[model samples]
Target: MTGPTYRIEVALTAARQLRKLDHPARRRIQAAVELLASDPRPPGAKKLVGGEGEWRVRTGDYRIVYEIHDHVLRVLVLAVGHRRNVYRRSSGVARKART
Candidate 1:
């Protein structure tokens, strides 16, 4: 346990709907999520301008969304749809920039 157990919320309503995916896809999503939750702000979890200072990363077909402060992590998953359309939306385009 670290940082008092970070909070994770799917930013888009559609993202919340991912709870029903089959095992394989579900595992990938889970992996990205756990990384954000447990590690030091992952390699791609960069900061976007708005959307509540949220961050994002990619894992194959899915995007890992998150927010990081001094000591806490908040993951706001925007989409689990598809590769192309995932980033087509503004929120997707606004993900934390990569260095």
Candidate 2:
């Protein structure tokens, strides 16, 4: 069973941004959030800070970024993005943005 999933305050903010979009885009965002909640694991180049770890999900032009730490969770909605840029060196911007 996929116990209760927690959308941390930060992740909630990111998800909120998606909620403001049109139906199709909003559904896309919802899908990505669900994907993250189900298995929020960072991929190959997922950025790493002192925090636990970070990962990215894409929905059209937006980037869904998040970090999973020891006892904390954070997420951000990044503009001017794509999956490629999501996993690039630019992840530092995302790390700082979360803080």
Candidate 3:
């Protein structure tokens, strides 16, 4: 039997963004997010320098930005977007405005 896995929590903005994506893109990102539940630091996952505990993974031209909380065993997905635009904005800027 499998042991416990980190829970995946998607931000509202990230969920909206995911919903707007094409079917293939959505599937790819969904798979990546699910993988984070089992392996928060999976191969090629990079820890973003400015945000402590925040990590990122890639799927094609898309990027998944998330943070791992060991205490709660959760993976919070903060953002997802194209490589060229994902890192351009501050994470907190749009969260409150839309949520």
lDDT of 3 by residue, 1-99 (tens): 765699899988788778888999999999999988888888888777656667788899998888889889999888888877676643642222111
Off by over 4 Å in 3: 1-3, 90-99
Full candidate order by TM-score, most accurate first: 3, 1, 2
Residue range with the least summed lDDT across 10 consecutive positions in model 2: 73-82
lDDT of 3: 0.79
Candidate order by decreasing lDDT: 3, 1, 2
Which has the higher TM-score value, candidate number 1 or candidate number 3? 3
Write candidate 1's Cα lDDT for 2-97 as tens digits: 554556665565455457567788788777776665663666556655466656677776665555654444555555645555445545445434
Q: How many residue pairs clash in each candidate at the backbone level?
A: 2, 0, 0
lDDT (CA) per prediction: 0.59, 0.51, 0.79
Model 1 scores a TM of 0.59
- TM-scores of the models, in the given order? 0.59, 0.48, 0.85
Task: Tell me the alpha-carbon RMSD of every candidate.
Answer: 3.8, 6.3, 5.9
Candidate 1: regions farther than 4 A off: 1-4, 11-14, 17-22, 49-52, 69-73, 89-99
Which candidate has the highest TM-score of all? Answer: 3
Runs of candidate 2 with Cα error greater than 4 angstroms are: 1-12, 42-45, 48-53, 70-99
